[model samples]
Every structure is written in C-alpha cells, then in structure tokens.
Target: MSAPMPPPTTLEHARWERFKSKLGGWSLTTYGILAFAFLYLPIVILVIFSFNDSRSVSKWSGFTWAWYGKMFQDGQIMLSIWNSLFLAIVSTIIATVLGTLAALGLERYRFRGKTAVDSMFYLPVIIPDIAMAIMLLIFFNMSGIGFTPWKVNFFGARLAVPYSVIIGHVAFNTSFVAIVVRARLAQMDRTLEEAASDLYANAWQTFRRVTLPMLMPGIIGGALLAFTLSLDDFVITFFTSGAGFNTLPVRVFGMIKKGVTPKINAVSTLMLVVSLSLVVVSILISMRSGSEDSVTIGM
Candidate 1:
C-alpha cells in the first residue's frame, strides 16, 4: 500500500498562519519601541533642559551654556565633583583588586564553607542601599571608627574624604566586581591555563601571561561599573560621610532641598555623560576582548 497522503493546505489556512506570524512580530517590535521610549524619554528631556537659557526647567526659553559654566564655577559643586571622582576611583581600584582575587580563589579552589562565603559576598549587592548605609553606620560607631576624613592636598586642592565613606563604597562595589569577573571566569577555557603550566610556567607566570589577559575585559567592565555606582551613590555617602564630606550626588540632594536649577541640570548632564561613556567604553572593550578570546581559542 502507498503511504497515506497528507491533507493539502488551504489558502485561507496559509493566510491565517502568515497573518498570525506577522501580528506576533509587529506586537513584539511595537512593545520594544514603547519600552525604550518610556525608559529614555525622561533622559532626553533632562539633556535638553540642561541647555536651557532660562533657569526654569519646565519652560524652554532658549539654549545656553551658562548653566554649565555656573556648575563649574560653584565652589561647593566643584568640590563635590572632585570628591565623587576621588571616591569612585579609589573604591573602584580597591574593589576590583579584592573582587578579582575573590573570583579567582572561588573559581579555582574548593574549600569548606565556600558556598556560605559566596552567598555572603553577594549580600551587599542584594541589600537595599539604605539598609547597607545604616548597617555600615552602626558598625563604624560600634567599632569605634569615627567618620574621619583622610585629609590630603590632592593636585594642590585640599580634599577631606572620609575613611568610613570609602570603606562603605568599597563594601558594596566589591560584590558587583566579583560577580562580573566570576562570569568571565565561567566562560573562559581552562585548557589555556593547563597548557601554560605544561610549558613550565609558574602560577604567577601563567596568570600574568595567559589568565590576566583573558580576564582583563571583565576586570575593566567591573571597575567601570563600580566607579559608576560609587559616583552615583547618595544614601551610603550621606550616612557615612558624617560632618563636612559631600559627594556630587549628596550635593545634588542638598541642592534639591533648596530648589532645582539649571545648574543642577548641567551637573546632572555631566554625570549622565560620564556614566554613559564609561558603560559604552566598557562594552566596546568587552566586545574586542571577546573577539580576541575567540581567535586565541581557535589558534
């Protein structure tokens, strides 16, 4: 007997299926556009208003760079900006080193209570900023570590950055860095390290020659993220900085209490640019690293 013939597709059925497919495609595309608009529309408004000639944020009188000039000229704002940069840079460096080491140890070693330690590392990342700030504040008081500034003449300008604040920024930033580096480690090929060892390279030599290069992208990305987080952090800085210390975000909050101005908009725009630039640079670096990694793996 001949195999049973399948039923022929009717034109209406074919048209219905194609229509459904097109509908689904259009629906997803529409949703994506709307979602992006919702997320970015406010940012677009902010950037535009930052250039407004008038002080009124609501009314667009004209365009001017006056606010930007004012932002730079304001002594307190300038101080805050410097403080933010200092905090971000210092915290990022410390967090990246600590987190990277943690990632390597956790990935390469099997130790008792490793699971618990790993979970604890992530606690700071998941905890609310307010809670973390409160916890840090309480800990500092209990530990007899007052919020004292590490006063130094930085680039001929004096800055009084609080030690407690630095520690607070580092505390949470380390978790973010660790998570990013650990992800990179998980994607890496272990064979390269083994090959390096087989070539009579010491542990440090293997890391310096092979592992570090592969991990550099993740390390850079994590550092950027930590820097951004520290720069933008308000709650922890506010709680930990104590008396006179002020970061840009904390200054912004203080400015808000007085009233919103075009100067605020200008500073906010500057921050937005810095943050977005860092993120973009990190992504580009990561993509380049990924390409390099693939080429190395193939070789």
Candidate 2:
C-alpha cells in the first residue's frame, strides 16, 4: 500500500478547531459552577433553614430564633456540648504533643526501619472509620477497659468520660496531626536552628527559642484539625461511648434517628459554625506565620 498524506490545511479544519476550543471553555466553566454549587449550596440551605420558625427543616417558615434558644435551654444538649468540648480539647492536646514529637523524629532523624514506622503513622489516617472503631471496641473489651468511665473532676463538676472514646480519638487524630506537622517541618528553614547551635545554645534552648516558635503555626493548625475531627466524629464516638454516654455528634445522631427538627438544625448550625471557626483560625495562623503551605489539613 502507498503511504497516505496528512490532511491539508483547510478553512473547515480551522473552524472545527475553533469550535472545539469554545466547547472546551464552556464545558470547563459549566463544570466549575456545578462543582462549587454541589459542595456549598447545601451548606447555604442548612444555614438558612436553621432560622425557620416551623419544626419542619424542609419547609420554609417565618424566621424565628426560638429554636436556637430552645437548643441552649435543653439540658441534655448543653451536657453533650460540654462533653464534646472536653473530649476535643483533651484529645487535641495529647495528639498535638505526640504528633509534633513524631514529626520532629521522622523529619529530623533517620534510622533503621524509619520508612516502615513512617508508613505505620499513616495507617490511621487512611483506615476506614468503621474498621478502626471495631478494632478499638474489640481491643478495649479484650483489655478490660470496656466502657469504663474515667471519673474526672473538672472545675468542681464530676464527669464520667469514656476512656476508650478519648483513646480512639487520639489514635486517629495523632496521625492527622503528624501528617500536617510533617508537612510544615518539611517546609521549615533549618538554618535558624543551625545558627542557634553555632551561638552555643543547647538543644533545649535552640528548640525552645528558635525551632518551637517557627513550628507554632503548624502545631496550632494540627491541633485545631485534631479538635475539629474529634468534635465531629460520630462513628467512633457512638461505638465507643457505651450506654448513656453522649458527645455532641453522638447526640446529634440519636436526634436524627428520632427525626429532624428545627432544633436539630439549630444545633447542627452551631456545630457548623464551630468547625468553620477552627478551620478559619488554622488558616489565619498559617497566613500570619508566613507558612501558608503548612496548613495541610487535607493530608
């Protein structure tokens, strides 16, 4: 067979190319709009419906703040909120300390099986929540820690918190915090630490004065992320909370099973506000610290 020649330059070919280019642009624009609308339109609706006067979340009723007032006045809701706050704060603190240490160790040092250890740190982050919850439940049961509440006295108010739930939250949150802090560490300038060392500063002094201050933004971001995750977690919380134990997320789930109401919407809206506030604070910290690259919460 004879070799075939390429298509000749023609007016029709030029017009086809122009048509394809316009189609590409329009398609991309349409998809972009759809993607944003898909993600955020529901959130806007949720916020708007939270003000509905009627109990029906799906129906548009006259605006009223009664639901919000009722939400605050509900003792169970207030207790759940308090429990959620305490759990998140405690878990975040523990996760931040451990995660920062892990990041520092993994980033600043190298050793045998270092790669293996690094991979292990990511398991909790990548694992399914249900699987982790089951494992934690089993482990607690086998270890004789099953559903035992830690009798904690906080500000003169005695609280019985599930140790397993806190442990589970810390377990997963540590990995998230480690990942974020590691990203920050990867971007940090090591020269500051070197200079401090050259100035005859000891290890602790160097870290306290130079390293920690620079790492503060990343640490704060990681802590906030941990707090947000702990606060919003329902699966693990519900599974490990045992009978009569309720955090805000678990309580929300129970209410959802009963049915949706304007009070539920109000409570959900409050939670949304809190989660969004934490995210905003993390971003702001990164921005102010000139380390916007460190807020890798998606990791």
lDDT of each: 0.87, 0.88
**TM-score of each model, in listed order:** 0.91, 0.90
Residue-wise C-alpha lDDT for candidate 1, range 1-299, written one tens digit per residue: 46434436778667767887899999999999999999999998998999999979989999899999888889999898889888888999999999999999888899999999999998998899999999999888777778878887777668999899999999999988898888779888999999999999999999999999988877887788788889989999999888888899999999999998888889889999998787677657867885444221101
Mind sharing the TM-score for model 1?
0.91
Q: Per-residue error at 296 for model 2, in Å?
A: 3.9
Poorest stretch of ten by lDDT in candidate 2: 1-10
lDDT of 2 at 149: 88
| Candidate 1 segments whose C-alpha is farther than 4 A from its true place | 1-9, 291-299
Candidate 2 residues lying further than 4 Å off, grouped into runs, are: 1-20, 153-158
> In candidate 2, how many Å is residue 126 off?
1.2
